[model samples]
Target: MRSLAYVAISVQLFVGLQCQSLPAKVKKCHYGDGKCLVESANALLRNFPKGIPEVNLKPFNVLPVRDWLLVNDSQVGGAWYFFELLNQINYGFENTTITEIRGFDKDPTATRIEIHGKIPRLVYKGDYLAKGRMLWFVDINSHGTSESDFLNFRFDLTLKVRIEYRNNKRYLKIYELVPNIRLDRWIMWLDNFFPDNEDLTIAINNLFNRNWVEFWNELEPGILSLFETVFLSLFEDLFEKVPYDDLFLADEDSK
Candidate 1:
């Protein structure tokens, strides 16, 4: 009876020591092959949103925005450069709320990740220089005429992303990101052009309302490109901040 009692106490001590060895922040996985890696990946994602404030992006600027307002350069007699400033702009995404995170698959070849979230808004507020197009019905041409405007809007976004690990570095390639534009209190303001005219403001708003689909279609490519840039760099930075051993610490058999 004395020998059996000693064995039980020894076993308990070993278990306790093992549990205490893992870092408190990371949940250790003890069973099944690949479970540790999966859990580690999940942990990485769970910690991802916390690092958003650290992901600072250089202002994304696209010049002479392709197919902007469906107006061609030749149609304006190659005078697009002056008006290019109207389309050339800086933008960013903010208030991103991640609703779901999945795809830490056990299969090594499985490369897909699905993330669902709401981006509270896309922000654009700045100045531009444009020489007006008289033919295309744009009658304004000056330095500050088309300057100082702002836009805030929301979208329900789902991201299907592909990832690859090479040379100990991970690369994320965006597969698809579908953003459904939401109409919840969208704010659009053009400060100097039509600030006081109620009817003209409504008319302009009605124009956007009538052709919002086209507007979204025009905006999608640039928005997605900017998003991919921000997130990829975000994950890269996150990985640098988080160590591999800390994330994937596991017993040899589990690996």
Candidate 2:
């Protein structure tokens, strides 16, 4: 019966989406415009989780992981080119609720949303391929599987987003996302491998956590780029299901 209800709801949503006309393109909202965009954003976010229960990516979704410093050759006691670690992973969040939204009061250009929820689970199953040289011999086939998981994480993130519009659609680009992620109460597993030679998983984890700030600094660029893609995709997909006018306000409504 519960499953049937879910199917019914999904169908209703699909029908509702199909019936709505595309929102008309309006004048762009500028910084500190004191326009209706802010109010519209708030209204749209408050109605979240009602129509947007989950957001995810499939295993086929290419999550490119490049320029990641797995373990330098010197530290790993060899020459390791943790070259390209493509994550063929499927992950997302469920039961999401937006707690608050700020900065849009005057500056719609820089807006922030406070979100509280659990990313039900994340399955990162991918290949750990690399190349290394040890003892004058290069092991080009440094290959294995990399699997990780976080059963249920209770955390909050402050998503700083930059909004843009093109062709009648609102584009939200994440400028900075500060997460107060609490995985301490949750069991997170990270099982990375590199052939039968050695299991440097523990050491690798420690190195990254050793200097939290530096670690994030070294990887921020790559991380931010990945986030931009994910967020843009999510917003684009969202507007597809929900009408644009329903999410943002028309210029005249602002005043």
Candidate 3:
């Protein structure tokens, strides 16, 4: 029954999209700025290779960010290059201005890679691919979204490369749950029907807390950041010193 209902609703949405004209060519994302999803993804992949590894010949983003560091192995700023790759890869819906760039020219530390720019988009918490095996070696996502013309046309897609290095050799492959998705119809359906569905909202919120504490711990550490930290304090470690002592008058007679 539920499956049939979903099919019915989905059909209605598709038909509605086909009938209504998309009013504009802009949409804002949690990442801020107004640009269609497909366009932003395209911008990211297209520029991935520009200032990448030393040679920049890889022409793909399959390697773990760490492994991609090797491409710049022969020069300084190799580690920074690794970060640059991520910056481009995670480009959310933001302006074309420089966001943030912090790293050593030749050497940098992991604890603090350094960051610049106003990164407003919350990182997509869940749905990471398999670790050792590069499933999304070649990610091709299409968004049939229309910011201007709403004739149910427009394709914004991206192709990302993934690879693994073993025994000093490289292996490459593609990964996807569904290789092809008709996002135009999907987004329209989601926008109208599930935008405020309680169950769906709960599911997305669950992902937010799934690793929430762990992420906070990474920012501040020690005995204070234990798994029990939630009970001990709500971000107590990050609190600034109160310095209430200064507020008191030296002449205890004011009382």
Residues 4-96, candidate 1: write the lDDT tens digits.
999999988755433222235546444222444444435544554333333221222221222223122443552342332244343333244
Error of 3 at 7 (Å): 63
Candidate 3's displacement at residue 81, Å, is 34
Give the Å shift of residue 203 in candidate 3. 8.1
Between prediction 2 and prediction 3, the one with superior lDDT is 2
Off by over 4 Å in 3: 1-115, 122-215, 218-255
Whichever of 2 and 3 has more TM-score, that candidate is 2
Worst 10 residues of 3 by lDDT: 80-89
- Model 1 vs. true fold: TM: 0.45
RMSD of 1: 13.0
What is the lDDT for 151 in model 3?
Answer: 22
RMSD of each: 13.0, 11.2, 28.4
Full-model lDDT, candidate 1: 0.43
Error of 2 at 90 (Å): 2.1
Residue-by-residue lDDT tens digits, candidate 2, 76-178? 6555444344554544432233333344333335445554444555445565565666455555455556654545545555666565554454445556665
Highest lDDT, which number?
2
> Which residue pairs in model 1 clash with each other?
none
Query: What's model 1's lDDT at 122?
Result: 47
